[model samples]
Target: MEQAFSGRRVLVVDDNADAAELVGEVMSLHGHDVVVAHGGKAALAAAATFLPDVVFLDIGMPDMDGYEVACALRRDPSFDTARIVALTAWGDLASRARAVACGFDGHLVKPAMLDSLINEAALAR
Candidate 1:
């Protein structure tokens, strides 16, 4: 797809490097500056420095789940303007509701379609 997010910054957090990189590449293709973090702690650390416009956070991780990370990010004033999107394999309504409760701005099921994902990213912008 053609780039639509030139100059934008996006953070991607996933334990699976391949999945994270795939999303990162897609964001990069859209001209966004993509930062990939392998876990919740790393993701938060990167957020402090990257100050991304949007964050794609995975629900499952070693140190912390996406819920904790989302709560933390929501509490941080630095990330107040950043859009937090839950990215997980769990696609059920319950999981999505949990993501919302945790302060995620949006929820994306794993293996998301490129168009829908890109659309959500654009909506965040």
Candidate 2:
């Protein structure tokens, strides 16, 4: 049976604008209310109003970077239950450790598979 995931608030943050938008589009197709942010700063700003349930964060942004963004979000009381997932090309031990240190709830390697992406996103719903 095809599982239907109800709409959940999702934020896709990446310096690669097209990648972010693509992921956001896929999330939307799978019944998520998705928002795309092109940088860490913009992601933070969007989170303020969007109050996303899951943040698919790219770790290599220019200004703030995803770890810093995750930390900032974790500091905010409104995001206590929010899932911060690292969406990065880097899957090294150091990178994973840093994500954990920054309070990320999970990690998904970039060029995300559609099925895995949907499953991970479903966690928020």
Candidate 3:
């Protein structure tokens, strides 16, 4: 299938270098303009420049958690409408509920298939 994520601006926030790269590569392959950040601080800085349509945030980060990042992003009027999807290893219903409460537009478990990632990104758009 032709990727549904084409031409979309996506921000990938993950502390794991390999994971970050993998996510960026996946989105790029699907024709998204992907920008990556190693932490929440960097992610916040990148947002201004990236102007991403959607943010894929890993919940477990050392410096700053995804919840903080999502909340901060939501506070900004410009990013208020931007989609914030929690990209984490947590797949349980409780985790999903927590993510929703933390302001995530959606929840995606780790090691997501390429099609699933693209589909999620499409929904965010």
Candidate 4:
């Protein structure tokens, strides 16, 4: 049987307010502690204090893209064990490859299924 996890610290980052809030709300409803960051900079700030167990990041922000944020987070020792998943509309092969190259643990396309989000969070270490 598969193991289960709950109450994880989850960070949802997206320049789109609705998207971020929606994901945050979903995670919260599923019993995870959720923080929504509207941009990459805010994401970094929130991560510093939130120290999330799992981060769902959007790739196309204007200020800083998810790839950059993922790189920055990967450099921080505190995030060494955190799961960073690219949550974006860019589902093309190249984008997925780029996400992997930038230290993302997983890649979920935009409008990802609710069950997928919960399952991903549960996989966080």
Candidate 5:
């Protein structure tokens, strides 16, 4: 999984600064170019420059939910092939349904296991 993700561009968005930094650190260790965005607005700004191949977005952000972020990214032609994965605390049936409806390519239940996100994205690639 690490080898597959290495050299790839990734974006990690979370309202919690610590969580985002932790994810960024983990991805960086595996040689992925990672950008950490603290909110949906910052995520969009980063996307403009970073053009990430994969995005891990937190669903419970106070400013902008992951669903909204995914919707916005999907509307952009540039992100048509980007893997937008929702990171949520909940992993119930309803949550999965909502994620599917929101244009996310995958879903990671939080404390998001990097393995799941990476493996799913790699397979898609």
Candidate 6:
């Protein structure tokens, strides 16, 4: 049987307020501590204080794209164990490759399945 996972601190970043909130709500429902940021800058600020175990980032934000945010997080030793995932509308091959190059541990297309989100959080454990 599969083992059960405990709650984790999750950060969701997106330019769309609704999208960020929706993801945050879903994660919270699954027993994760969730924080929603409306842009990359906000995400960085939140990460500094929240120290999330998992972060879901949107690639197309106007100010500081997801790649930049991921790179910044990766540079910080405090975030070495954090799981950063790309959660964006851009699911093309090049985009996926870029995500890896920028330090994303996983990639999920926008409107990702709820189960997938929960599973990603669980994997951070």
Error of 5 at 51 (Å): 0.7
Query: For each candidate, what is the lDDT?
Result: 0.87, 0.89, 0.86, 0.93, 0.83, 0.91
Ranking by lDDT: 4, 6, 2, 1, 3, 5
Residue 92 lDDT in candidate 6: 99
Q: Give TM per candidate.
A: 0.92, 0.94, 0.91, 0.95, 0.90, 0.94
lDDT of 5 by residue, 31-118 (tens): 8789999999899989989999989888888888888888888899999889888877878899889888988878788876777765
**Error in Å for residue 114 of model 4:** 0.8
lDDT of 3 by residue, 4-121 (tens): 4488899999999899899889888888899999999999999988888989899889899998998888888878768888888979898788788878998889887776777778
Whole-model lDDT for model 3 versus the true structure?
Answer: 0.86
lDDT of 6 by residue, 21-88 (tens): 99999888777889999999999999999999999999999999999999999999989999998999
User: What TM-score would candidate 4 get against the native?
Assistant: 0.95
Residue 24 local lDDT, model 4: 93
Cα misplacement distance, residue 108 of candidate 2 (Å): 1.1
The full ranking of all candidates by TM-score, starting with the best, is 4, 6, 2, 1, 3, 5
Candidate 2 local lDDT, 1-125, one digit each (tens): 43465588999999998999999998888888999999999999999999998899999988999999999999999999898889999899999999999999888898778887788887852
Worst 10 residues of 3 by lDDT: 116-125
lDDT, candidate 4, at 41: 97
Residue 102 CA error for candidate 4 (Å)? 0.5
lDDT of 4 at 14: 98
Off by over 4 Å in 3: none
